[model samples]
Target: MAYDIPPDLAGMNLLEIAEQVQARKLPPVDTWKPESTSDSRMRIAADGTWYHDGSPVTRPAMVRAFASLLWRDPADGQHYLVTPHYRQTIEVEDAAFIATDMRDDDGALAFRLNTDELVIAGPDNPLRAEGDPDAPSIYLAVRHGCEAKLDRSTWMQLAEFALERGGDDLAVTSQGETFSLRPSA
Candidate 1:
């Protein structure tokens, strides 16, 4: 799908774009999932180690859970229950990173991230809405990164990428810049 660049993002910086994407005020599409499930549980041991369902959780799972906690929930009283065994695989190729996550129902969540671009595949693909006549996958691409400072165009792009990709292989550059490119799992 093609994105129509918003006039407000014409001359923003990366930081500004990131903030705008975080705030969801950008015109470009921003897509995301729950980032955490509502059926999982966690516990902390006295050693400062964390456990999920009596077992040690992996770093990625922890990150996802933390990230989920940071997301604004649609349901005011509902909370995510992230699974300790929730496994995600990420693969990076050239300018794109492909991430796949397995849901409890055996369904799949796939995400594609590239420099300033994001796309997702799952039960709800927005691309389908554009008359692709197929289940549309969500797609967002950066039009101009260097000029996207306050517009958060990149973050909005990443959000779409994460929503489509399941946030498993989600990658951010050293400068906190997000990209679809990632290393293989």
Candidate 2:
């Protein structure tokens, strides 16, 4: 399926993106304490594809809806779909979301997720690089202890953006915080 870039974010600056980001109210999945737990029979593939019963979930809207309810258990480090009633576990091969695109407005970096969620890299939502040093994965902290891994193209874009800033270390500054693209050796 062809995915068109959201028109509003196409040429938006930091301030514009900030305003839109604040306007979005996510579900309070973190606050809920659901006792009942079970397998969701769902899986979020490493490539950011959602699956159920081993079948790909084709609807973007459904994926977005499920994403809104996603939360990570601090005790077991498991991903769950939390509601007021129950907590259903879901398999996450890598990150729950993928940073499909990135935009740099001055020092602030805005990332667009596979679910079309906009997240600005700042103190609240920090960036981290993990995994192998040769091919490290860069992730941005989304909500409810979930993170969005930067896709290959987005990672390349961020690297180029960082390079233009003339940094000795492979790093990028967003919202006054410098994030390293390579894992610490």
Candidate 3:
């Protein structure tokens, strides 16, 4: 079956994107308490590509559907696809999602993930800088204890946005929260 791909983020304004995000409803994986467990043999690469049985999943709809069921188990620090019936462990090399695009919405920061999901950075969903100070890997907290790593272009865009704010410290404020892009020493 053919699926209608979601509109490209570049064509939509922040408000429209935010509206879409708010309108969409996802499965309540958090509420699921499944007793059965198994290995999915699915792997999410560090670059945000999803692969099953060593084959890439190229369908946007399929990716989005699977992503909605994703959950990170705090006890084992492992990613899983949870359903009411069972929970299947999946491999994640880096982050589960990748922030492929970003835009400034008023004083806030908005991001578009590789799965075409929209996210706003704020108190509930915050930004964090990790890895080396010279080249940090910035991440945005997504739902269900998942995070989206800012891709190279998005990271550059964030740096430009931070520079526009003109602060000696490499920091940016969004939605009443301040995030330091420089990794903590």
Candidate 4:
């Protein structure tokens, strides 16, 4: 089985392809249920670093190649790198990726992830917060169920976009809908 990039997305850089991906139909990865399984020895660190067998996979292209095969198993709620013939279980420390950069896109918050994939925060691709109130963990949905954790720098940058809504809520409007990041006094 050959895994090929879509002809429309072929030859395009990550940022250019990301915009297309926002509209393009994805291969039905959720429907692909392969029986073969193996340990990949690939781990994504909390900081969005990829390591293979304890060594860092420093090559961006190689990391992107593997990222293309990533899938989240709804049945088990685990992430895997899937192929037509096999599935490899990979460890994720926090999220599969990180939001390395952020900016305003139209009226939405657009994120450039470590994978170079850009995501415009909307109802389909929303941003949310978790963890401690003092040190919240921000996460952005990149695709179907794949999420990217926002690092402190990106989080701070996102805060600059926040507006006070309904008196004391720190909310950001994306695609016309306001999502609250936190409550403020």
Clashes of 3: 0
Show where candidate 1 strays beyond 4 Å. 1-38, 43-50, 65-75, 81-185
* Candidate 2 C-alpha lDDT tens digits along 1-185: 23344676777888888888899888899999988999999999999999999999999999999999999877888999999989999999999999988887787999999998899998899999998977889999999889999999888888878778886788988899988988877
Listed per model in order, the count of residue pairs whose N, CA or C atoms clash below 3 Å is: 30, 0, 0, 0
Ranking by TM-score: 2, 3, 4, 1
C-alpha lDDT of all candidate models, in order = 0.31, 0.90, 0.90, 0.75
The positional error of residue 23 in candidate 4, measured at the CA in angstroms, is 7.3
Clashing residue pairs for model 2:
none
Q: Can you list the residue pairs that collide in candidate 4? A: none
**Candidate 3's residue-wise lDDT over 62-114, tens digit each?**
99999999999888879999999999999999999999878776778888898
Candidate 4, lDDT over the whole model: 0.75
Best by TM-score: 2
- Write down the lDDT that model 2 would get: 0.90
Model 1 C-alpha lDDT per residue in residues 65-145, reported as the tens digit of each score: 432322222444232322342322211111111122111111322222221322232222221111122222223222211
Error of 3 at 172 (Å): 1.1
lDDT for 90 (candidate 4): 93
The Cα error of candidate 3 at residue 45, in Å, is 0.5
User: Which 10 successive residues of model 1 have the least lDDT summed?
Assistant: 142-151
Poorest lDDT segment (10 consecutive residues) of candidate 2: 1-10
